[model samples]
Structure formats: structure tokens, C-alpha cells
Target: MVKKSVRNKAISSVLGTVIVLAITIALGGLLYAYSQGMFSNLTQNTNINVQAKIIVNPSTNDSYLQLTLVNNGNLGINITKVTIDSNGISIPINVYLPPGQQYSNTFPLTSKMIAGETYTVTVYGNSNNKPVVETMNVLASTV
Candidate 1:
């Protein structure tokens, strides 16, 4: 009677191990399928036209004005960085870009323009030589 009970227990253990192994293998196959599709997700099928709307930076008496940009693209974009120049002053801006997003930038008004002088702050992109949009005739005050 004792020998019979021990053999039955051993058999039960072997069956439980087999069931666990089968379940693990099935779940492994499911996970592998999901991993393959995740990379192809979020891809845009349409053409992307990058249009940027320049938002001029705010200016004060002690500091220069700034600008913000709106991306009107259909997909995501990697903007390199921001560069600003008008008349003679050059300004550098830290920038990041996303699809249909907006970012603000500040460019100093170091150019020797008199108070009440009007200037055009042309905003250009890193990818293209052309300006996406230009904020022209901004009111400048020397104060």
C-alpha cells in the first residue's frame, strides 16, 4: 500500500510539470507575435509637408524679444536647432520639434536699431534654407 501511494504521487508531479511547460510555450509564442508588430506601429502613410509658424519672442528694455514656432506637419519631425539673425545681431535658441506642435524661442535684440524702429524677425529652419515663416515689422522700443 505504501509503494502504490508513492508511485501515484510521482505520476501526479510529472503531469503537473508537463502542463506548466505547455502553458509557458504557448505564452511565449504569443509574446513573440506582439513584439514583431510594435515596431511597425505609428508610421504615417501620407506625405509629410513641414510648415512652421513663427512666434516672435517677447522683448523687454533690458533683454531681446523671442518667438515661438508651430509645426504644421502631418508627421513627426526632428528639428536640429534654432538660429536667429536680423540686421546684425545673432541669437541662438534651444529647440525641439514634434508633429503639429509648438515651441517658443527668444532672440535678443542686440542690433543697433533706434527706438520705434521696425524690424522683421525672419525665422528659418535647420533642414531648409528657406524661412518657414517670418514675423516682419515688429515694433522695437529702446526702452
Candidate 2:
């Protein structure tokens, strides 16, 4: 009787160990699959970043141009230079862009401009050493 009880107990212990190991393997496989899906989606959506439209308020004179720079990129705008081309005119604007922040830039004019003339503002970007250019259209009609 003693021998039979010992044998049965040993068999039960072996069966319990096998069952627990199987459960562990199954859970590990499930976790691996879940992690793979989560990481794949994260990498797929982080391609390009850009900035949004900014509000501008020109100075008291039509000869000067004021700008509000907004960082629409996932990073900083990294403005290299701000240039303006008003129908037969051209000038360089000053800029200072903070990371994920907005700043106002004021450009001094070298010539007189009309109130209803259209002007183009072009921003050159070099964040992360990669050069990019963006343009915005502005007019002197409204304040």
C-alpha cells in the first residue's frame, strides 16, 4: 500500500509541473505577438513633420513686415532665413524659432510698399541639418 501511494503522488506532481509549463509558454507567445503589433504601428506613423500657418501683424508702416512663426513640424522650424518678394521688391527678415514654440519676427524695409500689394514670405528650414523651404503669401492691404 505504501509503494502504491508514493507512485501515485509522484505521477500527480509530474502532471502538475507539465501543465504549469505549458501555460507559461502559451502566455509568453501571446505577449510577444502583442508587442510586435504595438511597435510596428508606432514606427509606421512617424514619417514627416511640418509647421502650421502663423498670424502676422505688420508694423505701423507698410514698408515693414511682421511675422508670427509657429512650429508645425514634429521638431523645430529651424529657420535659416526669411525672405520677402513683393511684386518688384526683396528683403531679408530676421527670425528666432524655439523648439515647439511660436515667435514673432520683424523685418525692416529698405523701400516703400503699397497697402494693397501682394508679398511672398519664404522660410528656409534646416532642422537636423536637412534643408527644406516653405512659402507663405501675405498682402499689405489689411492691418
Candidate 3:
């Protein structure tokens, strides 16, 4: 009588197929996430134009800043931050505006504002975590 020994493998053909398919699906998912980030970056890098005006309330003896943002790009934008600075004074604001939409905001003055002074206003926009910046010069009322 002759004795024969058989070896058993851990992974069969079907199990190997399943493992390959799982790895392929995981790699595909990772690639999709990476491409999404890249596309979002491309979309956010856009040209943004914002118009600003500074008005002083003579009746109230106070001054305020006004801004009109026009979204002329093809993509929608979300306003993230608005800042005004003059003579080392900084004012920060939060605003949201959409594409092809017009929005305005009035920022009150905390200190005495002088006439004929120049103020810089910066607006920041985001589209899919991408940033867009627009800066404008606002001259105070010389009245």
C-alpha cells in the first residue's frame, strides 16, 4: 500500500479574485478623492472683482464702509472674510454671496475717522476650499 499526502492552499481562485477586486475598488476610491481635490483647486482659482465705497454720516458724526461684490465668474463663490484697515486699525467681517449675485454690507466705525484718508478693504472668497482675494482703495469723505 502507498500513502499520498495532499497540500491545501489558504486562498482559492474565487477568494483571490475577491481580494483583487477589493484592492482595485479601494484604489479607485482614493483616486476619486484626489481628483476631487484637484478639481476643486482649479475651480477656486478665479478672478474676483469687488467694488467698495466709504461713506461718512455727517448727521450722526459717524463713518461706515460699504462694499458691493459682483460675482462675474462662471462658478459660485462664498465670501469668507472681509477686512478694512486704516492707520493700523483693522476691522474684520463675515459675509456670503453667490455667483452673479449682488450683496452689500455696512461696517460701523469704532474710532474717529478723518477726512481725505485712504482705507484699504480686502475681500476673501472661497469655492470648494479655494481662496480668492480682492483689494480696493476707499477714500474717506473730504466734506
Candidate 4:
């Protein structure tokens, strides 16, 4: 009777261990699946990037400041406003561009561009109620 009892106890101990291990594995798998589903529902927001260039068109005799803006990102942009700043004065312009597109505008200058002066251009856009801003600096031509 003593040997039979010992054998039963050993069998029960092994069976308990196997059940615990199986439960642990099942729980782990469920947790992994739940986490994957949760992550799959998450998404990344759209990003916008723009490149700008300023040049003096010789054909215009430096009377106009030409600006070239390019959208260089994967997302589309709905431009709302454009502004040029010189000596603290803000000039608003109406311009629009889409993704992977370019926009060029020439603004007439009342005075010649001074050497070493800095000019700022700001672009404001929107995407699904999100505001986007892009700024570029242009240095006055010394020539």
C-alpha cells in the first residue's frame, strides 16, 4: 500500500506540471495574438516635406523675386497661405500645390535686393485638420 501511494503521488505531480505548462503556453499565445491585433489597428500619420529655392531671373532684370517650391514627401498637401517677409513686412500670397508637385511664383520687388540680407517665406497647409508649415530662407544676391 505504501508503494502504491508513492506511485500515485508521482503521477499526480507530473500531470500537474504538464497542465501548468500547457496553460502557460496557451496564455502566451493568446497574449501574442491580442497584441498583434492591437498593433495592426494602429496607424502612422502622414508627413509633409517641402524644398524651396530662390533665384533672380535675369530676364526680369532682378525686378522680380522668383520662388520655387517642391513637395518632396509621400503625403499630399493642401496649401492655404503663402507669405513673404522682408524687413518685418508680411505679404500674403495665394498658392496651392499637391504632392510631388512644384509651384513657382514671381513677386515684383520695389527695391533692389540688398547684399547679405535675409528674406523669409512661410507656407501654411492643411491635411485632415492638421496644420502644416514650411519655411525657407533666401539670402540677397551680392551680385
What C-alpha lDDT do the candidate models reach, one value each? 0.50, 0.57, 0.72, 0.62
Worst 10 residues of 2 by lDDT: 44-53
Candidate 3 error regions (>4 Å)? 1-45, 58-60, 87-94
Best by lDDT: 3
Positional deviation of 30 in candidate 3, in angstroms?
A: 36
| Higher-scoring candidate on lDDT, 1 or 3 | 3
TM, every model = 0.41, 0.50, 0.58, 0.50
Model 2 ranges off by over 4 Å: 1-62, 87-96
Q: Give lDDT tens digits, candidate 1, residues 1-143.
A: 45654443345778999999999999998789768855334544222232222233336334456555665554444444333344655455445456667776544545445456565555444433323433345666543
Which candidate comes out best when scored by TM-score? 3
Candidate 4: TM-score?
0.50
Query: What does the lDDT read for residue 48 in candidate 4?
Result: 49
User: Model 4 off-target regions past 4 Å?
Assistant: 1-63, 110-112
Q: Per-residue CA lDDT of candidate 4, range 1-143, in tens?
A: 45654433355778999999999999999889877865433543444454444444445546446666666654566777655566443446555556567777666665555545677867787766778887878766532
* Model 2 agreement with the true structure over 1-143: per-residue lDDT tens digits: 45654433355778999999999999999889878774453332111223222223356444566756666445544566666655444444344454556766556565666666666767665656666676767766544
Q: Which prediction has more favorable lDDT, 1 or 2?
A: 2
Report lDDT (Cα) of residue 6, candidate 3. Answer: 78
Q: lDDT of candidate 2?
A: 0.57
